[model samples]
Target: MKTESTDANTSDQGLITLAHGAGGRVMRQLIESICVEAFNNPALALLEDQARLDMAEIAAHGDRLAFTTDSYVVDPLEFPGGDIGTLAVNGTVNDLAVSGARPLYLSCALILEEGLEISRLRRIMASMSDAAGVAGVSIVTGDTKVVPRGKGDGMFINTSGIGVIPQGVELAASRCQPGDCVIVNGTLGDHGAAILQARGDLALEADLVSDCQPLHGLIARMLAVCPQVHALRDATRGGVAGVVYEFAEASGRAIRLFEDQLPVRPSVRGVCEILGLDALHFANEGKLVAVVPREAADSMVAVMREHPAGRDACIIGEVLDGPAGSVQISTLMGGVRLLDLPIGEQLPRIC
Candidate 1:
């Protein structure tokens, strides 16, 4: 066991300094007081270089292990519904969940800027702990580094998650078929809209909040009812449109979404109209897009609606046998138009 360093100042009022990242007493004290205290668990308490998970325990849940990693750099750190910390935890969890895995453990690595407030770091870590608890995962190991003040943002988080995929379960974009139905769990682009408003650069205002949340529980329920789901993806960086496009390319099929069926919040729509940005091209955090056989579409939507995260679940489109790797939208004007991925960044630093 390591004892607390008597030479280091343990006050929470000061800003992060380069010394905090140096391999010294200050760094150890920071880890113990902030990260370990926020995410209290036996494995993390061990303070080892890596988490030693029990293989037997992990194998009992499933036949294979699923691992995923993601980095969060959303601007403003704190947004309407969640901060970068919460996004880091949930985003990685969703990556595993969409693969039909039960997320279990996560490792958090933080890059904090020198001169960053310790109080802010505390809040962020607390948020991460809460999100991990909600997702039923443990933060077992992590690393922290402090960068020069202007060289880094206030904070950046990178999370890697480990999960177990049960036997007899498989999902992939390549499995999609022409008769599959496309569904989204909720509205699109809320997170993008929320971040835009929070930035204050556009002088925009709305009641929008990021749809940031963990989806493993909802996905488990979805799989329980519709085991034959062809593909699953959470709408993130490039929103629902991005996910459908990937499915089209991978499956060698075309996907057509109905403009009227996209569940966009009024506030989000307003923001899009003002910026001339299509909500389809915006980003989302908590929403997922699923593909299921035509026969199971209604039942899948029904099961999804029973969960709070998916109350707006609805079929947005269907797979098509037309040109491969093409995505189209049936406009409300009774016309179909090709939807292509954006040329450049539609919105940067939008997790």
Candidate 2:
């Protein structure tokens, strides 16, 4: 039983140094005081190179497993509504949840830049712990590395998640039928807009905050009401617009979206307008875009609205049969136009 030395300093005033990643006393102190303390769990308590789980426990849940990984490099590390830590957990959890899985475990890896503050790292770890607890998932294994100053950003997180897929639930882009309805859980582009503001480059201020949150709970509720959902995706990097184009291309169908129905917050709209950006091309963290049979659309929206994370849920569009592999938007002026995928990076380093 290896125990951390009590003489080690765990004060907030401490700053991270390259030696902390040298896999010696300093590294042990950093892990014990920050990572282990925040993500306290039986599996992680063992301190093994990998987390071990009882096969019986895993088999009892379902017959299939869903695994996914995502990396976070949002430039500001910390944002208005969430930091990289919270985004790391939720992003991984949402990846599995959207595949109709119940997230079980997560593996977190951190890349720290030299000169980073220890207190900031602790705060990030705490946020990750809270997010994991909220989603009923455990952070079981992790690794840390430190890079030279200016080499790595302040911090970057890579999270991989394992989940159990529920029986009788199947989701895929190919399952989207021509008549399927398109639904979004909430407003679009909040995360992208918030990140831009966090950078302080725009010098624009609004009441906008990143819509970063865990969506598994909200997804669970929707599944309860409509188990036959055709497809599900959390609008992240490319926003709902990107998701629409991808699905259209994959399903060999066209997507028709009503611009008037998109749930963009007033503040988010202002940010996009001033910056000459399209809200659909921006990113989001907490929003989900789902496709369901036309018959179940209303019921799904109703159930989603009951959850706090989905109060703004609405059906924004529907799948179309012709004009395959294309996305079109209906303007409020009764005109229809192509909604092309953004050419280059609208916002860089956005998770």
What tens-digit string does per-residue lDDT give for candidate 1 at 6-33?
A: 3244455778899889978888888888
In model 2, which runs have C-alpha deviations exceeding 4 angstroms? 1-9
Estimate every model's Cα lDDT from 0 to 1. 0.92, 0.90
Candidate 2: tens digits of C-alpha lDDT, residues 72-113: 988898989999999999999999999989999999999999
CA lDDT for candidate 2: 0.90
lDDT: worst 10-residue window of model 1: 1-10
Runs with alpha carbons beyond 4 Å of true place in candidate 1:
1-10
**Superposition error at 97 for model 2 (Å):** 0.3
Indicate the residue-level lDDT of 24 in model 1: 88
